[model samples]
Each structure stands twice: as C-alpha cells, then as structure tokens.
Target: MSAEIWTGVRERVLALAESPGVEKVFGFPYGGTPLEDPLTEEELADLERYCGVRLPDEYRDFLLHVGAGGAGPTYGVFPVRRDADGAWQWHGDGGDMTLPKRLAEPFRQHVNPEELDALLADQPDEEAYEDIDDYDTANDAWEERLFATLWSDDHTVGAICLCHLGCAQRQWLVVSGPERGRMWDDARCDYVDLEPLGVTFAQWYLNWLTEAEKTAGTVSPSETR
Candidate 1:
C-alpha cells in the first residue's frame, strides 16, 4: 500500500483518544494515547537491517507514515527507538520477547495440539519426588526442557511481539516465512499452542481503530462497513 494509506491515521487515533469514554477501552488508560514519531527512511532501513527481516509491507508503511508505534491495539503497539547508545530496540511491556536476531529465520507455521497437551501433562510434580531437593532439580530441568520445546526463541522466529493483552498473553506479527504479514496469538505461556488471528497487520490495527472509535462514540455504526 502507498504511504497515502496511512495519511491522517495518526490524527484519527488522536481523535479516538480524545473522544468520550476512551478511558473505558480496555488498554487506553495504560497507553494514554502516546504516539511516537514516524520513522524516517533511514531509521526504517536501520530497523530492517538490524532485525534482518523486512517488516510486513503494511507495518513498514505505518512506521514510515503513521508512527513507529504507539496508540494501537490492546495496550498499544510496542515502539522501536534508538537508545542513547544508538542501537534500535523495541520498548514496552513484553517487548523483549521480540528477538531481533531471530527475525531472519522462518517462523514455525504449524503447531500440534496433541504434542502440546502431552508436554503439559509431563510437567514434573513436586509430590512425585521423594525429596524437596529432588523435586526442585527435576522441576527446573523440566521447565527448561519445556521452554526449549515450545517457548524458545526458535519457536517464535520471524515474529515480533506487538502488544500485550494483560496477563502474560501477547500478540505477535509474523515477519517471515509463509505466514509473513499475519498476526498470531502467543498463548504458550499458558501452555497453549500459538494460533493465527486470521488478519493482516493493517487489518488488525484498523479493526482495533474502528472498535476504539465506536467505543469513544466518534464513529456512527453506519460509518463502519
């Protein structure tokens, strides 16, 4: 999509933030409608280079024309910024989960529910151990193995954590492989397999915007399609 697609999106979001009862939105209070400055071409290039993956087209354009992040779905999109040391990093709650180095790798496209169930079932139980120390050791090992099997960086390759939905749940935007450009739900923290949201980055953001506007009474029902 052209940069024009993002034109006025920032203003539209600002409008939503100011609309009546915007605070009633689930994450509006925490986000407070803060919007970062849009990235320049140089900054966008640097981000893509550092991440080793080109962002989804819609997201890339949003970064260029709208804002790098801020005032988005849930608690708002995680913002990427250059630190004092001039290294680009995404900053927000759960933002560290987005491993920049792993963006080049292809994202795992499939999840086996039975295998996940089996893994959860195999969790070490303290009562099964004869001694507390044994239980601690065994539990640690099991936890490590569990993370390696399902929650490792390898499992989330080519995806970036975009927003958190309270608790430990977060949303990811796939940046590589066949699923590139789609959003995925990360419920592995709850021992659930990842699932697609069946929406592209733009669609996801726009849907949230429409809902937010409606909640704020800024959009009439007839205006939405």
Candidate 2:
C-alpha cells in the first residue's frame, strides 16, 4: 500500500476509536511474529503474489502501524489461542501472519451502520454488565434488564442480538439489547455488513490482548507494556 493510504487508514482508525459509540480499536497481527517468525521482504512479496488480491487499505495500514506482533499493548487486542490445546500465544514484533475470518467474526457482527447507530442511541450502562462473563454468559440477562429500564417506551432501539458467525475464536459481542422486542414487538436486526478477512489464526488471538487492555484502562501501548 502507498504511504499516503497507510497514513489515511491510521488516521481513520484513530478517529473511529475516538467516536462516541466506539469503545476501542483492535489490531490483529497478520503474517507472524516479528522476532520469532518475522516475515522476510521476499516472503511478503511471494505471499502477495500468491494471494493476487492486495489487502484492504485499512488492514495494510494496521500492519505497518503495529508492525509484526508485540508492537502494541497486549491488552485490547485478542491473543491467538491454540486450537489443539486452547493455550494463548502472542505473535512476536515481526512475523508473517495473516488475519483470519474466524477471528474477525466478533467485530463484524455489529458492522451495520444503522444497527450500530441504534446501539449507540441506546447505549447500555457499562456498569450493569460488568460481571457478565464474555465467554460463559447463558443469556443477555444484564443487558436485557438494563435495556428494559432505559428504553421502556421503545425497545427496537435497544435490542441486543448475538452474532451468528461469532467473534475471534467464536467469541461474541452485544450487538443489540432485548428491550426492542418487549416494547415495540419489533424483530431486532443486529448483524453488520462487513466481510471477515481470511488470515492467520494468530490474528484472532490479538483480540484477547485488546480485552486485557480494556480491563487495565490504559490507552497507549506503553501504559500496558
């Protein structure tokens, strides 16, 4: 990608992170680890040639901005989980990694701009769902309750729905709340339009790191590093 395009992508991502509805921005490592499995220039060229499709502008910018693994804070980004053993692993600072579609499932669920707008319009109290487990919640109980109280008159705007495709490593995000149904008898649509990228599984793991950062409440990588 051109330097100008890369710069534009970085600026856009940062701007999105600053948006009122956006809670955080996530970067997944593509290729591999920098120090452990760094991507050689020749290898990158070969892979690009093999793929035929140049990576998206924003995604390419992400690679340059974050480098190959270990470039940013471990938190906020999801870490790669080994399918064989379910153990977590981090990509080194430089490596030949690819972003996998499975890893991006979570973020794509709320990709629909309209749905996202609705979610933001009726944003739930962050405190209410603090205890909800990201991996084991049986239902959207906390979210539903909060939506009921917050948007009692209109539920369609506050409904929450699960992503059908799942997130990185089959993780899920709150795309809609329950109030939209009880109040408006309206069927909620929380799905987004973004397509998932097919890259290395390690990219999916980057999400775990992003979650960790959110827990720590630090912005810059240095704060979490």
Top lDDT prediction, candidate number: 1
Error of 2 at 81 (Å): 16
Q: What are the candidates' C-alpha RMSDs?
A: 2.8, 15.9
Query: How would you encode candidate 2's per-residue C-alpha lDDT over 1-225 as one tens digit per residue?
Result: 333433332333343344453344333223443212223445444434443333333333344443322323222233222334432222322111223222212221223456455755654454556565742252465457444433233321211111122232211111123211111111122323322233222233234344534644535333333
> Whole-model Cα lDDT per candidate?
0.81, 0.32
lDDT of 1 by residue, 33-70 (tens): 45778999999998888887888889999999878888
Clashes within 3 Å, all models in order: 0, 47
Q: Which stretches of candidate 2 lie over 4 Å from their true place?
A: 1-41, 68-212, 221-225
Best by TM-score: 1
Worst 10 residues of 1 by lDDT: 25-34
My TM-score estimates for the predictions, one after another, are 0.89, 0.25
Clashes by residue pair, model 1: none
Task: Compute the lDDT of residue 4 as modeled in candidate 2.
Answer: 45
